[model samples]
Target: MDRTELAQVLTRARTALTPQDVGLPAGSRRRVAGLRREEVAQLAGVSVDYVVRLEQGRGPHPSAQVLSALARALRMDDDARAELFHLAGSAPPMPGTVDEHVRPSVQRLLDRLDDLPTMVLSARGDILAWNSLASALLGDWSLIPRRERNIIWQRFLGTPDPRRSTVAMDDDERRATDAQAVATLRATTARYPRDPAVQELVSELRRRSERFDELWRAGGSSTSWPFDRKAIDHPSLGRITLDCDSLHVPSSDQTVIVYSAEPGTPDSDALALLRVLGTQSMTTAG
Candidate 1:
């Protein structure tokens, strides 16, 4: 791709956007569909001439700060940001293509988090390792085939009925998570185009769920963020609202997700009951 040509097109696209598109009110329209070039430059904390130079590919290499400003100004998505990095011949600023497997120390941490529902997940949300609480809250996750252990795969295959009757779930919440999962996968594909597991999961989701297929094609994606106000119905727990926190372990592409409910609340009571049931289930299996 011609960097100069791409940069020009990108700048034009940014210019065509209205101030309202970037959450600014149309103060007084002059002659453009979007904000004036100078307005964008001002908003992005760059010189109007620099913006012009960038658009024309005559600018010097942009610093990360400037790139970030431009990304915001352009309202670029993950794909766009990746493209910007490629055009600039810079390594991705965020984690990418991690040789991400669960380390022994991380594994030990997972084991110790048994009292908490927790899992070690790859950047793409693969279930690399899970603690017993996670298994207890979900199912006999260990019994799941390794290939089927992924969150994306589980969403598609975990239920056969369109209504997901086997699991009590809020339809909207389930769909929201499903959309977020697809977006996460999309971002992963951009970063690790050759990962076989990601490819397989994408293929399976497309085949198994029409909604997932449509959402994936719609270009859904997200930055790593905390999951707030999540609910799940454990066969044993009945139902519980969980506060889920996802933490990025520095220097590794793995994330540790931990879920908990407030003490003395109904959800907490459900968690306790689920733990009892999990112990019983394990005993029976043993």
Candidate 2:
């Protein structure tokens, strides 16, 4: 690996980003010119020590996965991402692989939706990006490891966040959701049969989660609904039901998931409150 060049590039990228670029608050009295090392660590789901070591040109060779996370965290463009992979002595993601990179336009769209809880998910159900309000309504996704960021993984294998407790859904609705996730994942695997990441994710989930295993074995298919309702247990807001809508991006094979509440309702008021509070209240409470 070109450790020196890698270190320089990583440092440059980190310093170029402001907190607001990554849906983080820009608090006053900051000493850093751009994002701090800890902030990059949080966004990349890596340790501060790791980031420090990497930037110092003394860290061990990062895996492709780590490089991918860092690229996303740094908001690298296509050319920059390719250079990062080359510097790390790894190949850039091929065409058939799951596209995790959120386009600049999509990122801007998320920023525009300031009041609603919005997130982008890959074909394999991995959460690729999210807005600040989404973090407030759900948990701070940045805190979760990149490998565990998939909605299918969270649904079947992840331990529930105590703060968000249960996603209140009827038995039928819950079952349907599970089936859809599995079917979607299955379809993704078929489309990218040679993708090791997709293969590994499915293998690991089937080995670890009994529910996932059962659904996978059943070979059931369900039509993915564009809209659904979910009652999420917010730590500060209590139970709030919101309309969950899925908008597909066909070019990238990604989905933008948005959560909205009807106007003039209690849930709408709660969402408005959440917008004002941002993620500060949740962070403090946790």
Candidate 3:
């Protein structure tokens, strides 16, 4: 990579963006045009030091995810995004690959949904981000290693809450869930044959789980993911059942899982309690 050119390009890009462009408050105490380093860092989900290093031609190459985030933060169009990747000495992510780039708009949505148990999952089932309530409802996914942070992997190979999830599944429901998961994985493999991470996941699942392989061979697929209810048997909160709905993001092909209960219900009360517990744990850990 031409560090000088890369730095110049990065600085130019950063200087070309404005607060209004990336969903930030327009401020009056501005000494310069475009976004500040801290603003860029916040929008890109990175640190200010990292942005400074990138602009100064001293940092290591940013990963694809970082590049994508920066491109989005700068409000670059598709062509500009491609040029940014080229200048950074990395090829732009091609179509058909699983997009790991969760847009800032999507991330903002997650951050704003503090009361709900929400999580973002990549097309291949990788857990990208989760809210505090999601951590309380499901396991704290962030603490898990990257390799084990996948829903399909967790279901098939990893030790996941041996004492059945509060999202109660009868035998038939279990079978359906397994089939759906396998189908999703199989579809991902078909979509991104060249993605090594995705390929490894599929290979590992097929080798490690007989049921996964059987379902894969049987070709489980549907038009879309189904809306379902989850019952989580919280060790403290007892059983809390909530409606589980998924929203598809066209830009990234990611799914956002939202957990909610009808207002004023007992389940809603339980979720509120879980939120309290989640907040307390975060505070204690901090």
Candidate 4:
């Protein structure tokens, strides 16, 4: 991640919002597209030097309240707000988790979603278990080595085969995804702070990816409700953006992510093609 560029973007985003846009009066003789640093500082309840420090990427990390104020002052959306946290380098405080021994119940819920593209995920975005449809959608999940089963690991390490078309996610998308991965892991770390798997994953990511190292210090956090979308490519499906939903299984630390396409869209056709290929594979195996 380009810290300097990110800082500039924050400043630019703040400047892009009109005073009237943020419910401030538009005074005479303003010569910029958005709010001034002093205005943002006043609105966010921080000092001009702090805002300047933030824009220069040299400030103390802002508290959540200050961050929220800035986000509002800059008219940031949810995604933008999350990205700001990433830029400022502060993670959210952890929420409590249920005990770890409840995996069986979670697995049972996974079984119930047999036809959906669903899987049980650990706090680190690790694929603890998946339904048959998820395995099918992912195209040969078991073929993945254990160490690469985590979503973040897969994205960073999985190179597309020559015959497979590349799915290029911009740096922002990759960073956002990685931030979620880290925050998910952070939440898990809070509950099972001693798990060797979690420790190993964190250490490996930190050592390999400078971006991960930068975001790791920020303590980004997320929950398992609502959904996010990603345009994914499969050798057979070509390219499809799946609408993915994440939910927490009651009394467990695991999350379930299910993917689907909009009804009657071309993406839906791609999902059908995937199902056909999956059926053929099953028949051949049988």
Question: Looking at model 3, which ten-residue stretch has the lowest summed lDDT?
Answer: 277-286
Residue-wise lDDT of candidate 1 within 1-286, one digit each (tens)? 3469657756766866765344233554478655677766754667779877777777778765466446545556556666776777664455345333455567557657767878777776766556556656765443444456567777776655222113445777677777787787787788778666577778888888888889988885775643666777544334577888888786566788888989999888877776655523423333
lDDT of 2: 0.86
Name the candidate that leads on TM-score.
2
Those runs of model 3 whose alpha carbons end farther than 4 Å from true positions after fitting are 1-88, 161-166, 279-286
lDDT of 4 by residue, 1-286 (tens): 3467557878889867775444344668987778888777765556789888878977675775466556644656556766777766654323342222224455556557655667666566655555556655665343454456577776555676533334447888766666776676666667667556677777888888887778889876655422488676665556788888888765555677888888799988877666545423433223
Please give the CA lDDT of all the candidate structures.
0.64, 0.86, 0.75, 0.63
RMSD of each: 20.1, 2.2, 6.6, 21.0
Model 2 backbone overlap count: 0
Q: Report model 2's TM-score to 2 decimal places.
A: 0.93
Clashing pairs in 3: 166-231, 166-232, 166-233, 167-231
Q: What is the Cα-based TM-score of model 3?
A: 0.69
Give the worst 10-residue stretch by lDDT in candidate 1. 159-168
TM-score of 1: 0.57
List candidate 1 stretches off by more than 4 Å. 1-100, 160-169, 279-286
